[model samples]
Target: MTDKQVLPKVTKITAQKRQGRYNVFLDDHYAFPISEDVMIKFRIFKGMEIDDQLQAKILAADDVSKAYTRALAFLSGHLRTEKEIKQKLQENEIPETTIEATLKKLRGLNLVNDLQYAGSYVRTMARTSDKGPIVIRRNLRAKGVLENDIDEGLREYPEEQQVENGVEIAEKLSHRYRRDPVSKMKQKVRQGLMTKGFSGDVITQILAKTHFEMNPELEDEKLQNEFTKVWHRNRRYPFMQRKLRTKRTLYSKGFQSDDINRLLDQQVDSQ
Candidate 1:
């Protein structure tokens, strides 16, 4: 049509060594290569007529086909949401238009479903991980899942399961803080549960039912360790100042007043 002719005649097509790819010839010269997906989409074959516009369209479609193959590889490990797929493509520096086209293909094939993704994530984390409802919801939201889908996912997590997990977590925390007073231990457990995303009601239930009992010998040993450290550190001060400082330090550490006074008395007598 114009002085600058579109140089393509689809002279021959042949399979490449790489799976799912082929080499195409035009005007009996080596032309562009295409994926099998592109070949099928365009019905490209030997001797097919191709103008400049068709050539450009084929190249763009091939771009999407390559990105689609990459997206499928990204999805091979586990199910992913649409946002995840987009992010993967973006990470690989795929073009925006190609990314959108690939996403359309994935959706058409029912491979990317946020609703199912969220629901499955909720179920898996609730059972396998220490993450609670609030944490799991935040995680899903961070992945750009819709709020409605998040809420639907949380439906798979029951309140009874929440309470059970809360109680188990509280018991472990109580043991960890066993050297502290029971009241202080409860405070630590409550704070730990909150950090782990347990609801206030579940924490309250755990505190009400679980009994945190520290052995008397362990408490005595803990008191000795604290008393030694404080008394020695305050040795540079006056004797009276040292005694007062030691008692205050022990008391603030959840040591019983009577136990602290007895330990301080023994220390003063030893000096």
Candidate 2:
């Protein structure tokens, strides 16, 4: 008898818990599970006759369908670069041919365009994160996006916008360092912006825009509060030793030498 003539008949098709997937039974025995896309593509149904050749085609189609489904799931929550998708499929041990077919299918549907992914990623990072263009480019490259696409994406984030974002970040940080010396505050702001991927030029522009202005009243108040605490803590020391200790403590707290000396002199005059 010919293989086609002796082929088994599908007895049932059972829906699996996973959405859009079904288990096919041949001659009352479990044959294979396939995605809805595959079922529709192959016209699979209960009572269908599946020859050995047809069964092979169905299994191959199922592999591609599963890979495509996985790719869709990966892309559902967030955009992914082509390289990222390939890596994900490889990690799942999907065959290279199947991966290629799945990716082609995705491309055909216009669902996996790197340019679109890059543009969206850049915009989201600019709006939400502190990352600069240079860092953003490197990140996109790592995700397998082409340099041209990266450049296209980065074009959306202009230098002026980066400076603005840097200034905004610096302003928020200034509140935490209000009591610190002007030099210390500027240094901290510069370092913070640098870590957030801003270039030196952008950081310079931001610092220039958000220049630190010392409030003498606030400085004096903070110094006095700090001096009182230091004084009580070093009450056991002699006056000169206590003064030296307090000056060092204030210096360590980011107060300038002049401010520390002036505050110490005021304490001595008062006592």
Candidate 3:
């Protein structure tokens, strides 16, 4: 009887390079194409090829690339803090090792910065309206900003400077409201400034300093000046009725109650 020969089944496929490196594969899946020199250095057999080991290394590199691409796509849509980006990657079930590798690449590119992002966010919100430090701090904290960074950003503007900004707004608005009773006009201006994100204390201080009192002797001259400003605003008011509506308009602007009544009474008294 002839002796039967037993041969091991080769399941893994490894690529061998004549000059550079060989391509490795597993069950029709390409793993990695390792260099010939690297293979020789590791004593990976030149003639005796192993598929199992080659498959493992290739799979690891594939996983890392996949995780990195996912993170890159997310950052393209919106700016994300490092913590936020990491959390998102992890939620997707990406390996921790992959996450670290991806974040390192992102950092090298300068694509993510928590500090700079927080500063721009604060400035934008501040411009929209005068949100106090309390609201601003809460917002930055929620975004994963460090406490020290928040402190530095907020400290850029002192309390006095913020109040001064409010005063400027009040002054510009006050010009249109001169016809309203001084007391009432001041109240309206205060409300306008407050709604604009000016602090209450700042609004009070501005009103106290710039009194918006009514002076009847100067009414005609003030009315002409006020009318010219309103007209220049690009509104075409019939000369007669325009004056009446302007009075009402001023009242709605936060003019004091007494100012409205006095102005109406005076207009009638004159007619």
Candidate 4:
């Protein structure tokens, strides 16, 4: 038998408490170090016990690489909920144990957060469009975010504020539909707000308060102007037949039954 002594390379040892566990890193990689007593027990009874730092480093690199790759894939797209990131990692064939560990690491770093993502998403969409809580919740749920996280993220804003948001969106649409008679203009604005995902109640309340400065009475005079604005902006359909097709267009915007009937009747009278 050859006589040889094996010693750990003692590359670089750093210690910290990660997720309440003593995590040891060697040469900037994972290192698994058994207690000296355990090593002696194995050496004496198990004939010979071998410990290799290189092997530990290899395993650690694999785990690190997986977690990192998953993070990059998620960040490459829109900001993702924690659940979305985890599911993507799982779909990519990551083991359950590794997924959990990696997720924990990401959470510790504040890189994967459902609530933060949800809050930011809602805020951005609210600013850019008129989407309400229902659409926001639906989108977040599709991303696999927890309901509690979504609820909490949106809880800070009063639900009634959605009506105010609806009003703002309606105001933005006013310039486009203002020329239609008051009845048709209101219907158009109402429908546009509703389709953006605002609740019926919020849409109604907001529509009741909103008024376009350019059109005080919102009568046929303003209606014609607003219709001209939208029609001219999008020359897709022949201008001659555009008003004839406005009923369906207004419906698609989300106008209510009463609003649609009143607007159609007024348009008929005006014709």
Per-candidate TM-scores read: 0.84, 0.71, 0.46, 0.55
* Model 4 stretches with alpha carbons more than 4 Å out: 1-61, 69-79, 87-97, 212-271
lDDT by residue for model 4 (50-81), tens: 25754454455456555665676677857777
Query: Cα RMSD (Å) per model?
Result: 3.2, 4.6, 9.4, 10.1
Q: Give the alpha-carbon lDDT of every model.
A: 0.87, 0.86, 0.64, 0.63
For 1-271, candidate 2 gives per-residue lDDT tens digits of: 6564567999999999988889999999998888898899899877788998998899998999889889999999888889999999999999999999999999999989999999999999999998888789889989999999988998789899999888888988887777776667788888888777888988888888995778888777877787789878987888888888888887877777887787677665233
Write out the backbone clash pairs for model 1.
none
Ranked candidates, highest TM-score first: 1, 2, 4, 3
lDDT of 3 by residue, 189-228 (tens): 8777766555677667777666454577565455445545
Which 10 consecutive residues of model 1 have the lowest summed lDDT? Answer: 262-271
* Candidate rank order under lDDT: 1, 2, 3, 4
Model 1, TM vs. native:
0.84
**Residues 1-271, candidate 1, lDDT per residue (tens digit)?**
6697555678888888989998889999888989998899899988787887898999999999899999989999799988889999999999999999999989899999899999999999888877778899889988989999999989998888887877778899999988777667888999898888878887788678777886788778988987899999999888888999888887887788998889777755435
Candidate 4's TM-score: 0.55
